[model samples]
Target: MSPVFAHGQLRLYLLSLLNEGPRHGYEIMRDLEQRFNGLYTPSAGTVYPRLAKLEEEGLVSRGDDGRKVTYTITDAGRAEVARRQADLGDLEDDLDRSASQLADEVRSRVKGEAADLRAELKAAAQEARRVAQPATGEPMSGRARGEFEQAINELRQSARSILRSRKTAESVRAEALRIVHEAKRQLDQLK
Candidate 1:
């Protein structure tokens, strides 16, 4: 699961790294691991394909340096990097929130309550957290049911909060419904 996120992060990091100057693929990978505190290291199999995609998208241009692929970001690539920079938080926030969410759920569920409820909730939460987080420091990504549910829950809570603040019941319902529609769009992206 984390491979997908790593792939995306690697592409962005390469773009950012090459902004300093054109660099070979190995240099970009080394720079990414350094920046991430050795948290992520992409295999050649992963990095090359994404580089190919970037080249295909015209975000990257390659210079011949013997057998090495030296990549320079094009004007279009620069624009995409900028656009992604703007939407970057939306992508990043999911991983960020997922981490804190596990701790928060653990804290809440472990608090005083009925024994069965505590035990059951704790076990379920633990399993979910384990599934969400990778053994390595890299985060889990890819289209999966867990992420879809989390996104839906986020939208549902957003809607409920919006609904709560409204003065009229009709407005509240309308706003919540709008949020639900937005949630569906988010889910569709996973597919």
Candidate 2:
């Protein structure tokens, strides 16, 4: 659970989601994950209990669609959503801040790891040079260049593998476009 949502914020947000359409527990979780750009996903333990509470409170009704149970917001839930529309806005702002913070943290961590890797490679290169020096005191340019090339190739392969495993290039481009559109919207709001 992210602290981004205050005490009862998740409950209200769930109602808002149901207000849009009826969804099972898993669908709601997936919706939240997608909304946050895969940054936050609530587990069944978290969502199911909350749904049960909402049903108990008469704010939402549950219907069994085959074996899956779907939740629909009742009139009471819609009234609550209407009453706290401003709070929903605040929830959106909180999610934006949380996503930005998480992105910053990931960026800084990757930068630090890359810097450390560079330092280690430099030290290893120096040690290799000391060990490979001939008695004639000649520079081992050929060997050093080969080793550097191999290291670069290995790094390239690792990067390519990661990119291939994580997502398709098209999906990455789509996500970038989504972010750009969101930024444009925020800028337009300012004007």
Candidate 3:
């Protein structure tokens, strides 16, 4: 459910959208998705049914554009749009607020998660160096240094792969935590 369309707002907004010009179902869906900054996308199941209902209500007329159905607002629909001018304004404001809030939340979470991952990686690198260095103050053997570097490189590549994938902030955070815990467990077992 979209925070932008809480009640019958979607219906009115759809009518308003048609008032602008005749649009195909996909166009309407794309416009809505763009309006919400890609945060909310209405599926075909959600959009087509509402368009069918609007046609049934005589508020909109449907025409065939090649194989596609395009919706155009009727006089009644225009009247409805004019009648609910204030509602349209309110809906626009709500959309603006919702999009801004979602963007801010994503930005904040990404920053925090990146910082946490950086700290964990730094700590792990420091620990690896400490372990590689012997207590006798002797320099680390070539084999020990190579192993440590390989492990750190693998960890860095894994983190990069995870971050590059598309996922919600919560899921990314959870996965990062799990990876960190698993790394710690493996390091402990090596003791």
Best by TM-score: 3
Q: List the residue pairs that clash in candidate 2.
A: none
lDDT of 1 by residue, 80-187 (tens): 778787555655564455445544543443342223333433343444444554446675566545764664465455455545653223533554455455435544
lDDT of 2 by residue, 60-137 (tens): 999997999989999999999999999999988887887787666655655554454445444444444444546687
Expressed as tens digits, the lDDT of each residue in 1-191 for candidate 3 is: 22656678789989999999999999999999898778677899988988999999999999996899899999999999999999899988887887888777777777777676756665665667565665578888888888788768867775876667664465666667676776667666555
Per-residue lDDT, model 1, residue 174, is 56
The C-alpha lDDT values of all candidates are: 0.59, 0.71, 0.80
Off by over 4 Å in 1: 1-10, 90-191
For candidate 3, report its TM-score.
Answer: 0.65
List residue ranges in candidate 2 displaced over 4 A. Answer: 120-191
The estimated TM-scores of all candidates read 0.43, 0.62, 0.65
Instruction: Compare candidates 1 and 3 on TM-score and give the better one.
Output: 3
Q: What is the lDDT for 13 in model 1?
A: 57
Ranked candidates, highest lDDT first: 3, 2, 1
Where's the lowest-lDDT run of ten residues in candidate 2? 167-176
Clashing residue pairs, backbone N/CA/C < 3 A, model 1:
none
